[model samples]
Target: IKQLDSLKIDLSKTAPKKENLYFKNGVLYKKGILFAKGIEKGRVLDQFLKKINFKPKSVIFIDDKLKYLDEVEKFCKKLKIKFLGLRYGYLDKKVNNLQGFICDIQHKNLKKIFCFIQLNRNGYFQIVIYFKNNKLSMLIF
Candidate 1:
């Protein structure tokens, strides 16, 4: 919360605009950050659109979970909004301790770990990760 509070928008320097970008999540902020309770992931954006009275023609939805991404993509298609889905992956360029990060995620969240690791076999590469019981069981490709 402290980190987010520090990153809050500097409204004094910027002029009010009709279009605004927001980070939707489970926690609600008093400053009007969009919050979606329960397991409804896509409804946050739906309610946000209605709250602002804005109808967008196109929207790009990026997420780590394939299921949630598919849900949002379908909703956007139903609304006639252009949709682009991006599967987020985590890669380290200058770090050698990738496994440490994976272990941390598994222990901390006990939820979906969307980070995909690339493995090379016979000069061919593949993305692999296993998610079960709210934990990352394996990461190999």
Candidate 2:
């Protein structure tokens, strides 16, 4: 929301007049935008549809992953809602083409700082670290 505000984008006109902004469960609603975390996209869409009083005649869903798009498409079919699922692969292509590497000295430093570091064939890195509270955190980049 803050990022949208910074860009001077006004979404109020397209948003529902009442109850347009709120955070419930793992979903965040701000004007015309809806964002969900820690949940499947299809489930999130289902939740959103259930909350609305009217059923939409059609739904257009776009996702970078075909798995998610397929889930949503199946859900839409169950409801008999006209559906269009677009699979976007721009980010996937970019990530796959990326060249990620660490110098010998950098690798040594990372080994000292992290509990484990694994570099995958796609040049992505996964790191595991232990905190002072004995909590384990894993990060992928």
Pick out the ten consecutive residues of candidate 2 with the lowest summed lDDT.
Answer: 119-128
CA RMSD (A), model 1? 12.1
Angstrom error of the Cα, residue 39, model 2: value is: 0.6
User: Highest lDDT: which candidate?
Assistant: 2
lDDT of 1 at 140: 41
Cα deviation in Å at residue 60, candidate 2? Answer: 0.7
The residue-by-residue lDDT of candidate 2 on 1-141, one tens digit each, is 654789999777766443653447768665767675656777777777677654678888887668878988888888899999998775575467545443443454553454655433334444445343455454443
- lDDT, model 2: 0.64
User: Where does candidate 2 stray beyond 4 Å?
Assistant: 1-12, 16-18, 21-24, 99-141
What's the TM for model 2? 0.59
Q: Any runs in candidate 1 off by more than 4 Å, and if so which?
A: 1-33, 91-141
Per-residue lDDT of model 1, residues 28-129, tens digit only: 423434344444546666766775676777766665557778877877877889888886645332223333454465566454656544432221233445
Candidates' lDDT values, in order?
0.54, 0.64
Q: What TM-score would each prediction reach against the true structure?
A: 0.44, 0.59
